[model samples]
Target: MSMRTYVTWAEMITGFARSGDSVSARRFFDQVPTELKNVVTWTVMVDGYCSNGQMEMAREVFEAMPRRNFFVWSSMICGYCKIGDVEEAKAIFDRIPVRNLVNWNSMIAGYAQNGFCQEALKAFGNMQAQGFEPDEFTVVSVLSACAQSGLLDVGKDIHNMLSHKRIKLNQIVLNALVDMYAKCGDLINARLIFEEMTERNSACWNAMISSMAVHGQCKEALELFCRMEKSNEKPDEITFLSVLSACAHGGLVDEGMEVFSKMQKKYGLEAGIKHYGCLVDLLGRAGRLREAYALVKSMPMKPNDMVWGAMLGACRIYMDMEITEQVAEDISTLNSSIQSGNNSHYVLLSNIYAASDRWEKAERTRIEMENEGFQKIPAHSAFMPCGA
Candidate 1:
């Protein structure tokens, strides 16, 4: 190919990377002359593959490169992290000749994303020990890990670092901070950050609203959501889920329904299984069992385990054996087809049988679950430490 043609292909590959079209990027890459495939081109392709969840393909490109630089290694590690392969990310990290802030950030992000909050913090500590300063991405990753693990003290320390260092909070960092405080049950700090943000994007609003909701501050969450509307910011599916969950927790049935309807009509966002689950919970809590059942039945998509579990809970409350049996059947069918659905269905069905004084049936369900080697474990959150 002529130099002009090669340059055009390279530019096309850059466009594909910018647009997150990894497939097209690879297609364009294949047309590049072997002699003309520079490190920059390979880095772009690696990044595009990572962003598009093609981590293995990214690895192939990374390995095939004539020479690998820090950026190339960081790109592959970040890709592995993005796909929740923390171990693979760490392996890449282990091989890097020199680790930069970007390298540490990738590992920190990987640990945080994989629910290793403590690990992420440890990684930050190690990064500092190696004479590297924590940047915005570092702070964001650690704060997110704190949020997931509810480590208030660690979160507070990070907050202090940000303030002492005078690190201006960008939207992403600010959102992570808000989430951390909220999960740690410090709504005051969460609110302070939320109010102090100079430019609040939709994600900022969603994080604040979600933090409030999860912390049981439904009234405050609702108020903030309304304020978001007044600010003319459009709510996404996540925002609606958080707001509806708040209403459901507070038993604000009317408000929940209004929000649910608004999500569909105003935002043009279709209600997914999660939204339906929240609505069902709201209606079930209000003793509108029949209405909840009808809503579940009328859903355009198939009701998942969560929906049936909510319905079954309501049936147990109302002692409605007929619908309980129907829900049990649905649960069983769902279990037979989908592997992950089995535990929740079995648990719900056992609870339903137990509530109705059908001890024998409940016992049978337990035995069956045990025979299938389905043991439900209590959920626990942990933080892992990542190192530079």
Candidate 2:
């Protein structure tokens, strides 16, 4: 009822929300006297629900509020964006009486993160047009959009604008720049920026290593990863994934195995399904199909579509119908939706069967896929703009 109690309740709710205990936050919020619930308290409750992905609860809290602030409005926008409901986020953004930089950044980030690169770029333009100077978060989000859409020219323009305005590039902005350049196939520029950075954090190293692996510079990627370790930066899951991918591409079987072992043994990071998939791909590329299959069988966790997909791809490459059939049987046992959509595994199996001169088996596979209600998804390629 008092101002002191109000402040304490607000802080407690915030702490609970930050710790992912939305139930406690809501309970605590309910205990606070209705008369004591200020706009800040209401906003915190709304934010807690939003952070926990309980949009219905968030909206209920938001709608029930006697008063709303800029932060609550921004939280709603952010919540919608996080859940990939950009249309709703945009609606909320449009309804804001006045928007701030945080609101604008949240909108751009939502669009970019959910693969709406063009919308993100458009929103970035709108924000700048409204005279809100792009901050580090804004710059990074916009650059990520550029990277996702391969808008190299647009990214270059942003970089030039930053240079023109003499804005100090922080680590995140620099990393975004490197990512944008690298994803746009401008490895030269990406590397140049990477080499010039005085403060190379784990993220900076990850950007370069991933870029190199993606562009088929497997040897260079591995070398950069080694340099990352020598600089005393600890490799996280992303770092290992990139390193394993590089080994797979380079056909470095021994190196890949060592890295895979090091991940679990030395670093104490569990090798996730993706790491297992990369290792399988590595072994498969090296004509170690049986070993790959054995590893899959021995996995601690259930193999997902990616892991199985990697195995199937290897089976197809080696024309190993035996393993292919086994993979098909294994996939059939799972309650996954792998067979419910445009099933690549089924198609791969049919192709493998046909490739091995087993037309009947191939036809049988197709029939089975059809029975499972899966149609082949047409292959498509992404279209990049000219000179991008």
Candidate 3:
């Protein structure tokens, strides 16, 4: 084939890869002449495989390459990272003769994705020591790692670096920064960034709303949701979930109901299991046990453990033993049928029995839990600074 024909084939392969048609891309690759399979062609093919979740195929292509460059190396490592193979990705990183900024970013991102926050931080330090200037992707990955690990000091250092480097804070990076601060429980700094951002996307709004909701700032979350609507940005499923969660947490029963209804009517988005759970929790918390049970029954799909647990919690709070028994029996039946590993349902049921002064029933429930090897996992807490 002529050079023009080769270029045309290469473009076709790239398009197929981008569209996630890896099978077609592979077929196209099979037709390419050995001489025409350049770095770009191979990289695109490998990326296609990786993006399509065929990491094993991606590795085969990576190994078959006669010569490897930084992009190829980074692509393969990123494939491993994407599939949660962090150890293999790190092993590749250690062996690369010419590691670049992209290589470091890919590895750090993998570590962060796998919750190895300390290793991600250590990798970032090592990248800087090796004279590779961290880019926006690098900063985002490290900030996320710091957020998950609750490394306030390290998060602050990264924020300062962003300012020092004069990196333009785009929506993605800004949202990550806000999320880091929010996760670290520094609402002050989180709000500061929210205020300074002249442009906010759905993700930014969602992050802020979630931060407020999780921290019991229901009023603020609702106010922000209103402001978000006023700005003409549409709320997606994530946005509604955050607002509903805020309402559930703050006991904003009326607000929660209004939002839930609006989600279906205005946005035309069907209520998923998460939204249903929030609504049930909101009603149950407000002593509307029957309403909550009615909502659960009305759901098109069978209620999950979370929905049942929410009802049980409400019953426990109101000491409604009559309803508690019904909900507990439903939960027990569902638990037996689905075999979901959530022990919280059993614990909640037992707690309800104990709270209602039904000693024999509570002891029987405890015995049942023990026989099934169900144990209550202790809750753990951590503290991190809001911003570095």
Candidate 4:
């Protein structure tokens, strides 16, 4: 085939791969002459397989290649990372003969995304030690690690470094920065960074709103939601979840109902299970147990354990034995695995019984829980420093 035809075939391969049709891409790939296949062509095939979750096939083609490009290596790392196979990604990273910023960033992001915050931080330190300057992507990944681990000091160090280096904070990096500060309990810094942003997207708005809501600054969270609307950024499902959470926390029953209505009617978004749970919690907290139960019954989707758990929580708070019994029965009807995993529901029901001076029922509930193989898993906390 002519060079032009080969280019067309390569483009077709990419097009197929991008459309999640890796089989077609492989058909075109196999048609290419061995001598005419370049590094770009090889990389595309590997990437296509990886993109389609055909990692074994990707590795097969990768191994068969007479030569490897850095892009191919990065694709392998990214593919493994996408599958939560970070150990294999690290193995690929360790094999890279000449490491670049992309390689380091990929490894760091893989670790961070997979909840290996400590490993991500160690990789960040190592990257810097090797005289590589972190770009926006690097900063964002490192900040995510710091946020996940609540490494406030390390987050501060990265923020200071950004100032010293004068790196132009792109929206992604700024959003990550805001998220890091907010998650680390530095709401003051979080708000400051948020205000400094000249352009705000949904993610930035969601981060700030969620942070405030989680920290019991319900009024402020609502205020920020208002600002988000005024700015014309469409509030997605995540935004509404945060808004509903704020209402629940603040006991803003009327306001929460209005927001919940607006989520479906005005915004044309469906109220997900979590959204329903938040609204249930909102009403349940305000001692509107009957209304909350009615709402749960009216939901189009079957209420999950979370939704039922929220109802049980309110029952526990108000000592409503009737609703507690109903919610507990509803929970028992769910999939056995879900029921077994959430012993908190059983515990809450038993507590409500005990609180209402029904000792026999509480003991019976405990015995039932034990018979169902529900063990109350001990809660634990870990203080994982970013530098670790």
The best candidate by lDDT is 4
Q: lDDT tens string, model 3, 1-388?
A: 4655667777888789889888899899888887777877787788788877788899899888777888878877888888888898888898899888888999999899889898999999999998988889999999999888777778888999997877768888898899899878898999999889988889889999998999889999999999998897899999999999999899999999999999999889999998999899999999999999889889988888778878887887898988887876776666642477777767677767766667678777767767777665322111112243
Off by over 4 Å in 3: 1-6, 335-344, 350-388
Each prediction's Cα RMSD?
A: 5.8, 4.4, 5.6, 5.1
lDDT score, candidate 2, position 242: 89
Per-candidate local distance difference test: 0.82, 0.86, 0.84, 0.87
Q: Candidate 2: give the clashing pairs.
A: none
lDDT of 4 by residue, 1-388 (tens): 4655556767888999999999999998998887668877888999999888789999999988888887888899999999999999999999999999999999999999999999999999999999999988899999999999999999999999997777778899999999999999899999998999898999999999988888889999999998888897899999999999999999988999999999899999998889999999999999999999999989888887778778888997888888788777766676433544767767667777767777788778778877887667322112112342
* TM-score of each predicted structure versus truth: 0.87, 0.91, 0.85, 0.86
Give the clash total for candidate 4.
0
What 10-residue stretch in candidate 4 is worst by lDDT?
377-386
lDDT of 1 at 3: 46
Q: For residues 1-388, what per-residue lDDT tens digits would candidate 1 score against the true structure?
A: 4545556766888789778887889898987787777777777787778777788888888888887777878778878877888889999999988888898898898898888877898888999999998889889989998889889999999999997777777878888888889888998988888888788888889888887787788898899999998896789999998998889878889999999999999889998989999899889977898899899889988887778778877886778888777776666656642555447666666767766678778777778777777666212111112241
Ranking according to TM-score, highest score first: 2, 1, 4, 3
lDDT of candidate 3?
A: 0.84
Candidate 1 stretches with Cα past 4 Å from truth are 5-8, 17-24, 316-319, 336-342, 366-388
Error of 1 at 18 (Å): 5.6
All candidates in order of lDDT, best leading:
4, 2, 3, 1
